[model samples]
Target chain A: MSFEWPWQYNFPPFFTLQPNVDTRQKQLAAWCSLALSYCRHHKLYTLDVLEAQESPVFNNKKIERKLSMEAIQVVFEELRKKGNLEWLDKNKSRCLVMWRRPEEWGKLIYQWISKNGMVNSVFTLYELINGDDTEGEEFHGLEEWMLLRSLQALQTEGKAEVFSMDDGKGVKFF
Target chain B: MDRFSWSSGLLEINETLVIQQRGVRLYDGDDKAKLDVGAALLSTHRLIWRDVKNHECCLAMPLSQIIYFEEQAAGIGKSAKIIIYLHPTPANKEPGPYQHSKYSYIKLSFKEHGQIEFYRRLTEEMTQKRWESTPVSQPIPTGSATQTGKTRAVGIVGIERKIEERRKETDKNISEAFEDLSKLMVKAKEMVELSRSIANKIKDKQGDITEDETIRFKSYLLSMGIANPVTRETHGSGTHYHLQLAKQLGDMLQAPLEERGGMMALTEVYCLVNRARGMELLSPEDLLNACKMFESLKLPVRMRVFDSGVMVVQLQSHSEEEMIASALDSVTDKGSLTAEEFAKLLGLSVLLSKERLLLAEKMGHLCRDDSVEGLRFYPNLFE
Candidate 1:
């Protein structure tokens, strides 16, 4: 699916960090929502500084304007302050982009499980991520780290129980 | 003129007329004197009257001949009159209008203006009684010298005399206008108008007044044209003064502010205000205080101090939003602009232009690009 661009994406000044406090606040808010939607559209769970700069979300060649490394960092910092993003390292070169939180992923999975009458069925992590039965679901392409976090969210709610099997980790839905 | 003796019978050889007033009519008893609508001259020795159109027909009476004098305040549409009570005519009288008169006093009515000031000076000359005392050491060569000069002056000599007389009057007018502030206060209303017209006439015609004095005089009189300025004596030294002053400032600055985009520096206000006040000098503190009252008094203008301590007086209608809009429009019209470039484009000072750009930025209508090249602003597309 193609991601629709915000009108500000083509506006040159939108690529630079505004100097005034009020203007900068509005600019950062616009940037935060744009980054989240772009990530959700492409199912991007993580980002790195170099790769992020190369992303269409930050670089717009049509207008020949791109966010500087420092300005991009400022926008990410704003997103982190709002609790939508997390740094993966001390240097802030890499980050986790949680467009869909673990709780939301857990809710989607539980809805799918109860609808299919598989409330008490047990499933391996790989089956939930890549199984033929889950191929048509929103969580079908979930990464291992994201799958574990979703199951942990379900466990906190007492909707699922995770245990170690001989082959790998598995979750039994309540 | 005919009611009194010929003008020569009035003054001593060395004396000259001290002051002259125009459009005076003399009264003999209750009837108007036949010779009227003339100029009146005040000398230390006598009161002389000369027909304005016919300068040769002049009449004079010595100050010693007057017993006392008083002023008749003017009524509606009536000229101010000065009644001079005289002692009886001496046994030996010169030839003129009447052989004798029934009344002991004669009146001089100011048909146009300034009988009051003339009366005041007349009283002063009478009280001093200079004719009874020593002759003035620096004697003016008047009656006898002029008579001789007229006969001998020819060609270049005649032209020089004409220039000398015109220059003398022009010099006198300049001195009277620039004289002590206290003296100007007493006769300011009428005198300011009189001098401004005369000075302006002299200003336009360079060769009429002597070049040296005219050049020196023009500098001071360039802005000296106002009349009846509010003073401490007129509006007490209280808040009342500031109110009157603020009102006057509002009236005066309205036109100038409109011409200058509805804003001006406080220092410019001081110069413009003081120049319009003419002789009365205004101090900076008083000007600031008066300007401060503009808004409180609901005037059309108000004084403002900036964050960086710059002070300005601007029209009440001038608003921050308007300035920001204008700035944003200009920047967008040109893609982007720096403070200096905008200043040149809008004919505004760089500091004011910068402040306007900053205001636009603060309002989120524009954003700045500050770099090694310089600070420039572009329209805020992020909105």
Candidate 2:
């Protein structure tokens, strides 16, 4: 499926940090929302600042305006402040994007599991994520870290449990 | 006052202007008769006192009517005067400013240090009695002035009545000055001063002229009018014209600068200066060129160009350090501020506030936090 871009992606000044306090504030907000929605549309689970700058989300080839690396970091920092992002390392070279929180993902996975009559059923992490039976699901291709976090949320709520077996990581739905 | 008759400032056919003293005031006996700092001209035929701003409020009497005159030495808070005792009003007296009075004498108070010269000339003219020898030449043409023979008198009345009478007089003089362009040019200085005095009187009585700020600001601009703007035709062109223009601009900017928080945009100064000059509009190039001489000419106000290329006219009294210090204070008080917020706090424009904030930042008294949330300034904790 093709990813949809926000209208601000075409604006040239959006790449540059506005000098005016009020204007810059609005620009930052737009950047934050655009960054989040773009990640959500592409199902991007992680982002590198430099790599993101090269992406269509940060660089508009038609307008020839590229969001500076520093500006990208600023947008990421704003997202982190809002709890939608987390730096992968102390150096902030890469970041994990969470357009949907772990708890929200857990709710979706649980709803799917319950609809599929999978209660009390055991399944490997790969089967749960890449399994054919879970195909056509919203979290069908969820990343490992994101899947693990969602499973942990369900485990905390006593709805599901995960175990490391000789074969591989597996989950048992309650 | 009754001994004086309404007269045009024009000289009689055979008469000539002998001496002229500006800043001379007339006294109705001892009371200030609202003669109000006029230009007193001693002609070959008569002594004429005309309001310096209102050319219409002129009074004259034949020098022959002076019984005698003597110099009254200046006292504290009082100008030196020449008290002239006049012969009683003749039964066929020409219509004058007042109908009756108890005092038979009037005083010419010289406020501009010309009492001695005027007194000497008066004595010489009185001894010579030049008009008697010439008989009575035909009265000079009164031009388009309306016949002002309406008998007006100072009545013993309340303060309200006095204010009403003054307003009437002001209205008449203003109308007369507007009779024609040349006539207005001749009387512009008189009108400016007259308005200034009236404004002062209103301010004194009411604490302010009006609740409307635009009206007050307009009146203020009008009151500082350049009565005689240096024109290329009169002062000639080149450096001298610009110098005179610069000087005139300096004189005209003092009050406005004080009122506008010691700084103004060059455009605003141009607007205000042209407004004060009335029809004599100044070109932007000329204004810029004239302002360039402000520093060398040692004017109180100067031209300043911001780093962003905006030109401002500021009073020399407002220093950069003071401006930076004020910006720092506002930032510290507010904890943090944007240019718009700072502008609101200081009653300044966003451009000026931004410049001030940048200045403070340059001084290390403030720090800028520029983010997607927009830029804000905070007092520099490290400094």
Best by DockQ: 1
- Off by more than 4 A, model 2: A19-22, B1-383
Task: Compose the digit string of candidate 1's lDDT tens values, residues A9-30.
Answer: 8766687788778889888999
> Could you report the DockQ of all the candidates, in the order they appear?
0.27, 0.01
lDDT (Cα, 0-100) at A2 in candidate 1: 80
Residue A21 in candidate 2, Cα distance off native in Å = 4.7
Q: Tens-digit lDDT track for model 2 on A92-131?
A: 9999999988889999999998988989999889997898
List ranges where model 1 is wrong by over 4 Å: A1-4, A18-25, A41-43, A49-56, A59-73, A90-93, A114-117, B1-198, B202-251, B267-287, B306-310, B319-345, B360-383
List, residue by residue over B24-121, the lDDT tens digit for candidate 1.
99889667898859988998877888898877687776667778888898899888899888776654444456767888889898998888789878
Candidate 2, position B254, lDDT: 86
